[model samples]
Target chain A: MRRIKCTVQYDGTWYAGYQVQPNSKTIQGEIEKVLEKIHGKPIRISASGRTDAGVHAIGQVFHFDTDTKFPVEKWLPIFNSQLPNDIVVNHVEEVAGSFHSRFGSIEKEYQYKVYRGPHKSPFLIHHAYHVPHSLSVQKMEEASRYLLGTHDFTSFCSAKTEVEDKVRTIFTISMEEEENMLTFSLVGNGFLYNMVRIIIGVLIEVGQGKRAPIEVKEILEAKDRRAGGKTAPAQGLYLYRVKYSNDN
Target chain B: MRRIKCTVQYDGTWYAGYQVQPNSKTIQGEIEKVLEKIHGKPIRISASGRTDAGVHAIGQVFHFDTDTKFPVEKWLPIFNSQLPNDIVVNHVEEVAGSFHSRFGSIEKEYQYKVYRGPHKSPFLIHHAYHVPHSLSVQKMEEASRYLLGTHDFTSFCSAKTEVEDKVRTIFTISMEEEENMLTFSLVGNGFLYNMVRIIIGVLIEVGQGKRAPIEVKEILEAKDRRAGGKTAPAQGLYLYRVKYSNDN
Candidate 1:
């Protein structure tokens, strides 16, 4: 048996999420169904993490073990042909048996898009979160600086998070605006559930002058979920990339 | 009565077409429904032209006569609020009563997008036509030169077209490649039913080396629908702009 790691890209608009759930369409359910057809048996796969519904992914990594005789090179085309259009298998490779998709990761990058056009664009309906009001990107950048570095991100994560250790190291947080679209890129060793969205919600409030840029520091010190602002909508979030130490 | 002209943009993936049919969801049907709701009576709109099913538009112009007291400045926000997310009323203006959206137009520009990515992109599934095969844009440009003048375009239109006059002047044809997307822009005095799509089909054939660049001359001289190649898919085509003489 050989363990295989594959990179996937998907538009999560129609998916219930990445995980398999009965009576609902999911990215994992569709992928495993295709894998079962290929291997003639049930096959389980492990993903880097779960994304909520309406969140997109450009490079989400997953690993699965299979004992089939199919050549590794042909896996890309074979999986793409059978899977739906929304999910694409970008690259495939053989990995060590002990390499875990979730645990062996070094860093992950995520992006959130916000459309600031006065009128909502039909082309961006499912791809971006529309904010008609004007925003100060400079103020947003100032607020984002306070979110960089290692800290307990309990205030920025969902209240339902079960993990006792809320500490995570955020290496970088950058913001760019082009053509009425604001994109926020965050790289970190790990992120708590809904952490990025909650951070974005607070930064947007800062940009709008509703909250001071210095308020971010106080929110992080509070270390409570109630200190954070509302969570941003799911559509604008994208799982941009996942990095592993082996560089595969 | 005031004649209100509006520039509309839409993603045509969910609509049957631009025309009003008995039992179909169309761009015109939706606009008319909103107009009726605002006016408390039936209202008909005249558009620059009709777009086939799955065809998109960026600057489709339409005009309707209304006796309502709503200020002209308020029409943009009012119409946008009532329309669905897939359709946006970009701009609204008060035009001369005699200025017809269809007849007063001096020029129209259309764009066709071809995605050259090896794997289908879920984000562009409804926005562009995916052509995985390698295409020579230089060869396509060579072929398009033969079509850049006033000529009898009977061979480049749909066989089901009802118009008797097939003569039209193509002012320009430009091709641009950025990233993995190739966009073809055409400016003409007018286009017959599916004329732009048929021309794109022939040009794509030239790009693929299936036909010589000079064959376009023969096809145009034939004046027969069977002489031209297939019609390109509607999704890649967009009515990018419509120009009028008065410039309202």
Candidate 2:
């Protein structure tokens, strides 16, 4: 009975999401199927968090307990061989038995990518959200100031979210612009369902001058989903990193 | 009748190649199908050159004469709406009737991208060729100098090539390295079949220290296909630009 943690990366273009579902392909389902073949039993694994369909990940974390005799280094190549080309397991290591991939997490970082140009590029169609209009990065940054610190993010959450509590602390929200591409990175303790995408929608409005920067504070205080802008598409969002207390 | 010239871009992952073929999906076939739907008759388009299967293009030029009453600006969005997501027509204009896309071309620029890293990224799987070893860019550039100017490129062409003349003038061969990614850009008046890819395979060997830089001169003089290295894969090669005698 040893627990092992793995850092995973996936394209997420062909997945139904991270969670397992009937009659659908998923990131976790693919991993479990490979593990089931190796362990010769039904093996359950837990991820740091769930991502929506069409989203991507860079350093998503997961943990599973196994009694197999394989070494730690062999897990990466083995899992990669069995997994589809879209999903890849990067690194594997032995972790403490009490470690939980989700509950033990301290913070996470996410990025929403946007390509602002007149013509859409075929190469970037799968990985980025194309905006045919120019964006003001300074305006987006000003609006982001209202999203820092602990607050009830009800306005930024999905309308059909099942969670009761909506309070979360956003450590930072930063935007980087290079030519026609803009990337928004958000670091937070935890995020509500579809929170990042909804926040990005609001920021895009500010960047486009449809909404003022100071209006973000009003939306946050309103505590209603309708107070915010429409949710951005899922393909632009990515789970960039998951931070834990031990840095393992 | 208007001679419409369009700059096209494609992912090329799902197509047979750039040219039309029997019972095969191709870039030209798709464009002609869209034109046929617009004109109620079959249309033939001539591209600057043909690209192999799985080869991407950023600035591929093509021209077709059409009697349709649509404006130049409307052709882009109209053709885009009818075409698949993997292919796009970027710029469309009415060119001179005598401006042929293939015969009127003076030069072409192509690039081969390489990712020199230990890990393969899912995001870059379709765009870059991954080499998990150190490469000497200086050595590759040194070997490229031997391939410059007018020469017979028979040694660097495919064995299955049916072209009679092998004489072509290579304007330049330059290498640019950014972090672990290396790009080799080549400019030439014309190219033999599979010439750029075969030349890249020889450069890769020079970078890997498998062959000396001066050996490229001997191979070029041999004028035999067996005198060169293997033909590199098609995915990493991109048709970057095409220059015509006139601005049209």
Candidate 3:
């Protein structure tokens, strides 16, 4: 059996997160159904991570083992033809059987988009978080600097996160502003549930002058979920890319 | 009585069209419903023009006569609050009683977007026309020049158009490419029904090497609907702006 790795992109606007549940529509559920149809049997695929509803992804990765003799080149077109319009299989390749989509990951990058337009744009209603109030990007950048490097991100993750270890190494945090849209990019070894969204919430408050830039340090020291501000809406978040060792 | 002119924007993904129709959801129908709620009586609005289903608009103009003593400044916020999230009221101003939204328009600008990505992007499904095939933007520009200036656009309009006088003046056509998206902008005194979309269809054919650039002149000279290739999809088209004399 060959383990095939695939990179995917999805809108996530209509999905009930990525995992399969009883009756809710999900990205993984749709993909597995398509695979089952092609393989003539039930097939389970593992993803790098799960994203909440209304979140988008540009380079989410997954893998499934299959014994079908279907040509590898034909997989892209056939899968795309059968998959829903909102989910696209971008790249597919044969990988070693030992490669795990989830545990084998080395790093991940995420982006959050904020529309700073004075009025909400119809085109961006679903794709971006609209903040009509003015913000200081410079101040937000200052606050983001405090988040770079290894730290216990307990305050930056959801209270519901079940992981026992809240420690993670953040490699970079960058912010860009273009055409009335503010994008925040974060790269890290791994992320806990809602970690990026909670960090963004705190940074936006800094930008809004509700908190001082240096207050980010105190929030991290607090090491409590209550120290984090409100979580940003899911629509603004995007799983930009997932990086694995050896460029897998 | 004051004739209030308002600039509006809407995402037409869900509406039937811009015109009010029996038992159909429409942009005009939604706006009129909100206005009637404010005026305590049924009110009617006249638009600069009508857009087909799935067509977006960034700067559509409309006018309504009302005797209510509502403050002009409050109209912008009040209308926006009541309108659906897909529609936004950008600006509002009182105009002369003689002003007409449809007849008083002098120029209009329309933009059509074509996505050149090799794969469909989930984010742009409703906003851009995805043409996975490579297109020659230079050739499309060359063909667009032949369509500049005054011409009888009979062949470039929809066959169902009711207007007898198909003559219209096209001032300019400009092409801009940014990232994987190509935008074609057209400015004209007025446009015949489906004229912009039909022109885009023919220009895209030229870009695809299906037709030569000079052939656009012959198509116009044919003065028959069959000469025009196809009507490009409405989703890629946008009513960018409408201009009137004296900026009223």
Candidate 4:
């Protein structure tokens, strides 16, 4: 048996997200069904992240154990032929069996896109959230800085999450604007449920003058679900990358 | 009556294209219906180009005749309230009576995005074409030069086209690549039916060594349907912009 790692890209629009739930049409279920057909055996694939519904991914990583010894080159075309149009297998490589996509991941990066202009766009409706107002970038940046280090992010995480530890390390969070688009990239050792979206929601409030930049600290210390920020919409969230070390 | 020039954006995935047809939904028709409802008058919108099915647009110029003197700023929210989520009315402004979206347009630009790698994706299935081979960019650029300037583009136009003159001027044809995504931007005075698609198809052939760079001129002069390449798939094309000179 050999472990094969794959880098995947998906337009998560019509999907029920990346996880496989019983009797649900999902990204994993779609790929798993196709893989079963190819291997003529049931195969369970493990992924770097289990993205929520309507969230997109450009460089998601996953791994599967296969008994077949097909040439490396044959994996792509054959896998793509069976996958749906909204998802594709971008790369395939042999990896060590000890490598675990989720636990071994050293960092995860996410990006939130905003079309901040008075004009609405049909083209960007699916890819970005349109905010037809003047937002203070300086305020947002100031508020985001408080999230750069390790902290107990209970106030920012989704209240429904089952994780026991609320403390996580955020490596960096930076926001930039170009023409009609504003992008926010967040890098972290790990993220709690709805963390990025909730952070953006609060930052937007700060940018709009409704909240003070220093209030970010108050919210972080509140340790309450409603203390941080509003959750940004799902459409604007993209799982940019999941990084795993080679030695793993 | 006032002639209003509006910049529009739309995801052509859901509609038949930009033109109105019996039993079909189109970007123009959808906007016209919205305007009629807002003003309680008969209105017809004319677009700068009639994009084919699944071809998106970012800055598609359009004009509509209206009797109501409603403020232009009000048009954004009112029309957007009535328009579908896939279509956006970005800007609306008063224009001279002489202006026509199609006839007065001096330049039109289009972009085609193709994803090239060993694997294809499922999520972007409806938006881009998956090509799993490396393309020679140098050859494509070399052949694109042959497309510049005035020429009879009958070979590049679709056989279904009904235009009397096949000659058109191409201002620029350039290629840009980022990682696994490759984009072809073609800016020209005008285009025939399926012209951009055919040009991309021919360029792809040239990039793959299936044809030579100089063969583009031969294809243009042939004025025969069998002389050129196949029409690219509709999903990969985008109507980026259409331009008009002031005081024209």
Candidate 5:
């Protein structure tokens, strides 16, 4: 048996989410179905984390143990051929048996895209959140600094999540704007459920002058979900990249 | 009555085509349905041209006559609110009664997007043509020059088209590449049915080294549909812009 790691990309528009659930189609379900067809048996895989419905991913990582003796290079073409149009297997490699995609990872990066035009673009409707008002990127950057570093992100997490440990370390937050498109990139050791979206929602309010940039410190101290701004829509979020500690 | 002109954008994946048909959903059909709802009667509109199924448009122009005396600036928001998510009315203006969207147009620009990578991208599946081979953009650029200037482009048109006049002037053909994505932009006085796609098919053959750059002259001189390469897929094509000679 060998442990294999795969880089996955998907358009999450039609998926229920990343995890398998009864009576719902999911990214994990789709990947497992393809693996089951190839191995002639059930195979379970572990991903870096779960993404909600309507959230896309560019470099989602997953690992699984397989007994099949097929050459490692054939995995990408084989899986991509069986996958649906909205999902693709980009790269695959045999890794150390103990390399866990979730627990062994050092950092994860996510991006949230926003279109700030008064009229929403037809092509961007599925990929970006539309904000008709002009956003102040400078103000948003100021607010984002308050979110950097280690903290208990309970105020930014979803109450629906049962995980009790809300502490996470954020290393960097960057915002770049071109034309009417604004993109926010957040890098951290890990993210709580809905933490990135909630952080963006608060920054947007600050950019719009509805909330002061300095108020984010007070919100983090509150440790309540209601203390932060509304969660941004899932369609605007993406799992950008994942980093492992043993990388070259 | 006011002669209203509008710029349109649409993702053509869900529609049959741009023209109206008896039992098919189309860009024209959707727009007319929304206009009929607003006017409480039937209204006909004329577009610059019809785009085939799975073809997208970023700056499609159309003109229609309306008697409601509604403000021109309100037309875009009103039409967009009534249209589907895949279609949008980008801009609206009141044009001269004699100005026609098709007849008054002096130029049109179309773009063809190609993704050159071994693995298909999920996000670009609906928007670009996936070619797994490494393409030579320099060869394609050299071959494109043969297509410039006025010519009888009968060989580069669809056999199914009933239009007898196939002479059209290509003002420019430009090739731009970024990473593994290649875009071909062609500006012409107008296009025959399937002209842009057919030209791309020939250029792709040149890029792949299946045909020499100089062979394009012989193909154009043949004036037969079989002389040129196969028509490229419709999903890779986009009507990028339209131009009119009259004063703004």
Candidate 6:
């Protein structure tokens, strides 16, 4: 058996989410069904992480085992031909048997995009949130800095979360503003349920001057959901990438 | 009666186009039907230009005369409450009687976005065309420069074009690239049918080293449909804005 790792990019607007659900269309489920047909056998895929409904993914990594003798180049075009236009296979490569996409993931990064302007862009309306109010980028950066270390982010997690250990190591937290768009990029070892969205909600409040930079630190220490702002909308967030070391 | 000019934004993925057509779910038809229900009178809107099927618009200006004296401040919220989530009324304001959305336009601008990257961006999948091959941005820019200024763009016009006058004034043609995304911003007094799309087709050829920049001038001079490259896909193009000096 050969372990095949593939990088996929998909517009999650129509998908229920990354994981398979009962009678629901999902990004991973669609791709896996197509892969099963191509391989002429049942192929289960392991993804780097799961994204909520209406979210997007850029460099999402997945791996599956196949007994077929087909080459890497053939898998992409063949698999993509069967999949819908919304989901696309970017690259496919053969890796060692030990290469498990989810288990091997080290750091994952996500970006929450917001467009601050009088008018929402027709072109990017679905991909970003339209914020009528102005945001202080400097203040947002200061608030983001409070989230740059390892902490139990229970307060910033969604109430629906089932994860018991909320202690996750955040490698970097950066906010960038270009013209009318402001983006928050967060890299962490792992994210709990709705963690990124909740963090973004607090950051947006900081940017809007509704919450001070000090509130971010207080929210993390509180370990209570009420300490943070409401969960930001899901469509504004995107699973950017998943990193893996060479040994893995 | 009051004439209100509204700046509209739409995803266009579900829309047939901007115009109302028989047996078609169009942007105009959708908005008009909603207005007719709200106003208790048939309402027709005049738009700056007709966007092709699946082509999105950010600042698409449209005007309609209403007998009911509805305040401009509540116009957007009220109209948006009726409009589908795919189509949104971003802003609305009262315009002078002489201000016609289609006829009073001084200049119009469009943006055609193309992305050349190893991985397709899931977030940008709907808005931009993903061309995996590496492209020469300088070449595309050089070819685009030939399109600036007054020109008889008959060759660039669609073969099925209905407009007799192919002569149009291209005021500015600026091409800029950031990272993997290449954007062409074209501002013109008026456009021939499929003019911007065909221009982008030729520009893409230049970027791919398939055609020379000097060939662009020859294509324009030919004044025949076969002279220019194929029309660019509609999904990659967006009607960015329609300009009227008073509104901005």
Across residues B45-125, which tens digit of lDDT does each residue of candidate 2 receive? 999999989999999999999888877899999988899988989999899899999999999999999988677777878
**Per-model RMSD to reference:** 1.2, 1.5, 1.0, 2.5, 0.9, 2.8
Question: In lDDT terms, how accurate is model 6?
Answer: 0.86
Q: Which candidate has the top score in DockQ?
A: 1
TM-score of chain B of each: 0.98, 0.98, 0.98, 0.96, 0.98, 0.96
Instruction: Report the C-alpha lDDT of model 4 over B1-248, residue by residue, as the tens digit.
Output: 88888888888999998888889998878887887777788677888878887889988888888787788677777877889988887888898899999999999999999888555655445577777777899999999998899998888888887798999999999889988789999999999999999999999998889999999889877889799987889989999888898733
Report the poorest 10 consecutive residues by lDDT, candidate 3 chain A: A70-79
Individual DockQ of the candidates?
0.89, 0.71, 0.85, 0.66, 0.88, 0.46
Candidate 1 C-alpha lDDT tens digits along A1-248: 99999999999999999999999999999999999998899999999999999999999999999998778998999989999999999899998999999999899999999999988999898889999898999999898888888999999999998988999999999988888999999999989999999999999999999999999999999999999999999999999999999886
* Clashes by residue pair, model 2: none
Residue pairs in collision within model 6:
none
Better of 1 and 4 by lDDT: 1
> Candidate 4 on A121-239: residue-level lDDT in tens?
76667678888788999999999998889999999999999998999999999988989899999999989999999999999899889999999999999999988767988889988
Full-model lDDT, candidate 5 = 0.93
Local accuracy of candidate 5 as per-residue lDDT tens digits, A67-105: 989899989988988999899989899999989999999
Candidate 3 backbone collisions, by pair: none
Q: Sort every candidate by DockQ, greatest first.
A: 1, 5, 3, 2, 4, 6
Span of ten consecutive residues with least summed lDDT in model 2 chain B: B117-126
Q: Tens digit of lDDT per residue, candidate 6, span B89-187? A: 887888889999888998999998898877565566567887888778888778878888898899999989888888889998887788888888999
Give TM per candidate.
0.98, 0.97, 0.99, 0.91, 0.99, 0.90
Chain B, candidate 6: TM-score: 0.96
Please, what are the lDDT tens digits per residue for candidate 5 over residues B183-219?
9899999999999999999999999999999999999
Candidate 2, which CAPRI tier? medium
Compute the lDDT of residue B71 as modeled in candidate 3.
83
What DockQ results for candidate 4?
A: 0.66
- In model 5 chain A, the worst 10-residue window by lDDT is A131-140
Give the local distance difference test score of model 3: 0.94
